[model samples]
Target: MRIVSFGFQTWGRKTLQALIDSEHEVVLAVTHPASAQSYKAIWADSVEELAKEHGIPVHLTERADAATIDLVKQAEPDVIVVNSWYTWMPPELYQLPPFGTLNLHDSLLPKFTGFSPVLWALISGAPEFGLTVHRMDEQLDTGDILVQRSLPIGPTATGTELVEAGMALIPGALHEALSVLEAGTANWRPQDKTARTYFHKRSDRDSRIDLSWSAVDLERFVRALSEPYPRAFSYYRGERIEILAAEVSTVRYGGTTGRVVVQEGGGAVVCGPDPIRGDNHGLVITRVRAADGTEHSGAEFFTRGGYLTDVPE
Candidate 1:
């Protein structure tokens, strides 16, 4: 099948490679241009570099402009495969392919349907998360599912770890969807409207930690935002401190929320709630990056009485 793929970042590279490895012909590969912003997220293999190595044509653009649409139309693609893309694709672009568009989403549809689906799924304390290859519609991720599979999220798994696990399944997932299409046995199901949850793209504020959160939730939040996504952060002394890793405190500390309860080799123990069930729990911040751009053990950064609050302390 002739395919035109639109993607970016690591997921893009994986999905494109899956297509190349398969029997299908990928005529055009489209990706986002390099960013000039400081604090870029973690990345894997470059989609552009991989496409060039495979001799696939590359198109770099923010939006699917007239020329891009024209280019895809010229490719005469059988299907459009889109994964890990940021642009809002118009129907004209996805509808160009005869087989319709297949979108590779990080989570199963009707749940975690929007930006950072994996992260949102993890933070929501879901026992499992999955990937889905769905037929794209006019709505965002509201497409009918063609194929889906779920994987367990281990207790200690970080966001990067989960991402890698999902990436490992891409080749098989894409193959499954493609095979279904080839055999004409595609089973499409509409996502349950009641079970749907849409997560918006994160911002600096989204990464900001609220000490009011329970230790378990705080830990989940930190891991969810860890490397490749932005690290969950808080302000201290008018400087931003990114929390790379943290743990639920062994001992409960009662004081002002976000107050530094202790500074030990284990990390900075911050006061939250007494872990009695639903109250805020304590956190042991294991690792952090200071405002001066220096990474440090939480013990090295937080002094006794130095609170890690939203407001500078």
Candidate 2:
């Protein structure tokens, strides 16, 4: 089938590559211009370059403008496929093709519908995260499902790892969706919006550590914001420090939340909620990075034994 692709960053590039390798024809590619945002830079693969290398038509735009719509209309694709297109897509654009638009979102539909889905899923403690190819609708990711693929989230899985795993699913899932579409046997399933969970884009503020959370949650937070993405961070001694590696402490200690109580597990035991009861598992910060860009073991860095506050002390 003839296809038109809308995407951005590494996710977009991978989707375009899969479409190029498939039996379908990718007639046009629409992608956003480069971004300077921290998150956007992490997976900074060039969709425009790949499309151009293959001699497919490429249009660089932040969103689907009238001219982009006209370009798609002229391309006259049989179907439209989108991934990581960071803007609202009007119905006139998505519904232009006969088969409508097939969006490849990096999460299971009816959950993790918006930006940074893999990160949000890991932070939310979901056992599994996956990709879904669904028909586009008026709402964001509230479309009918055509194909779905999932991967188990291990206890030690990081956000980067889960993202790569999800990207690997694109080839199989896209191929399956296209096959069904070609055979006219696509079994589209309606999403239960009641189970839908949408997450906003991640920003610097989202990485700030909140000591009120349980140690397990904080540990997961650190892993969710693992390298390439912003590390979970807090302030200590009026300086910013990024938590690069952490885990739940095996011991419980009582103290005010954020207090650097004791050393344990080759790291510093930082108190969380319910400290007075002495039943809380403190967060064991194993590794950290200072504002000056130096890395240090948590135990070595927190030798002064202060508190990790969300704001400067």
Candidate 3:
């Protein structure tokens, strides 16, 4: 099969590599320009460079403009494969190929759609997360599913680990989908729109720890925002502090939600919800990064005892 690849960053690069290694030929590659966003920089692999190295024509565009459509028409690909390609693609573009466009999303369809799905799945205490290859349509991630690969969310899984796992699923999923498409035996399943849960793009503000949440929830939040993806953070005594590692406390404690009430195990216990009733388990922050960019054990940093507030005091 002749293929056109639309991708960005490491995800796009990986997809292009898989196509290059496959039986099909990649005729054209479309990708976005470099981004300065911290999230985009994390998995920074150059799809454009990879395509150019292989001598495949590359088009850099933020969206599917008139020139891009003309290029795809000239390539005359049998199918289009996409991953991490920002911006909307119109029907005239996606529906151009005989088999239509196959999009790779980082979460199971009918749930966790839209941006940063793996992180959102971890933070929401989901049992599992996976990759999905579906036919692109009018709505975002609402297309019929062609192939899916899922991984269990372990008790201590981090955002980085799950993302890598999902990326690894791309080769197998893409190959399988292509085979089925070639054989004309693809079993495309329609998504149950009722079960769909879409998430918005995350900003730095989304990482702020909400003290009202249970310690269990907060622990998951910390793990979800683990290394290479912006650590969960809060303010302490007019200074910002990033929580790098944390867990639910062994002992229960009650005070104001953000108060650094006591030292427990190897960290400091921050009181959680229901302080008046004094019945909530505290979040034990084990590791942290201070405002000055110095790392410290949570116990060592909260020695003076103060409140971790949402904003500078």
Candidate 4:
């Protein structure tokens, strides 16, 4: 099969490699124009580099411009495969290939159908998440599913961990779906409209912590936004403090919510709800990053006796 691949980040690399390994002729590779500031750079290796190595044409553009479309059309590709590119693709672009375009999404369709699906899955406390490869339609991620695979999200797994796990399955799923497409026996399942849900892009403000939330909720918040994100955070003395690691505790202190309850072992306990069977919980701080850009243990953050507080309007 003559394939045209549109992708960015590690997922794109993996999918392209899979197509190559599957004995398909990848004639053109398209990716986003590289930028230095955003973390997109981390996962981006020069697609041109890989294309050059494979003697394939490469297109790096901000959009599916006339030149890019011309390049793809010239490649005479039979199929178009989209992996992790962030831009909105127009219908005409997807319709160019004879076999049509297919997209591999990191989350199961009809549940999480937008950007940052893996991150939203972790924040939603879902124990399981999956990948889906579906035919591209005029709508985003609303295509019929050709292949799907689910994986468990361990209790301690971070957002990055879950994304990595989900990304790992894209290659195999893409290979299998392509085989079905080539054999002219592709079986697709329609997505349930009633089960569909979408999440907007998360902003820095979304990472802020609310002391009024239960401890378990706060703990989950901390885990979901850790590392790659700015970290779940709260205000203290008019300065932002990032919570890097935390635990939920049953012990309660008479102190007010967001007040420091204890400081020990380089970590500190913050006042939160006590645990209940069907109802309450408490949040504890195990690690943090001070506003001055200093990373500290929970105990270190507490030595000054500064307490977590609601952000002032």
Against the true structure, whose lDDT is highest?
3
Candidate 2 residues lying further than 4 Å off, grouped into runs, are none
Candidate 1 vs candidate 2: which has greater TM-score? 2
Q: By summed lDDT, which 10 consecutive residues of candidate 3 come out lowest? A: 265-274
TM-scores, all models, native as reference: 0.90, 0.98, 0.98, 0.90
Error of 3 at 32 (Å): 0.7
Q: Write the per-residue lDDT of candidate 3 for residues 1-313, one digit (tens) a residue.
A: 9999999999999999999999999999999999887788889899999999999999999899999999999999999999998899999999999999999999988899999999999999999999999999999999999999999999999999999999999999999999999999999999999999999999999999998888899999999998788889999989999999998987777667788854674454555556777788788898989999999888788888888888999
- Write down the lDDT of every candidate, Cα atoms only: 0.83, 0.90, 0.92, 0.79
Give the CA lDDT, 0 to 100, for residue 305 in model 3.
86
Candidate 3 stretches with Cα past 4 Å from truth are: none
Q: Write the per-residue lDDT of candidate 1 for residues 172-288, one digit (tens) a residue.
A: 999999988977889999888788889987677888898767788888989988766778888877778888888887665565666665534545445455533424447888788
lDDT of 2 by residue, 10-59 (tens): 99999999999998899999999998887788899999999999999999
> Deviation in angstroms for 63 in model 2?
1.3
By lDDT: ranked, best first: 3, 2, 1, 4
Query: What lDDT would candidate 3 get against the real structure?
Result: 0.92
The predicted structure with the larger TM-score, 1 or 3, is: 3
TM-score of 2: 0.98
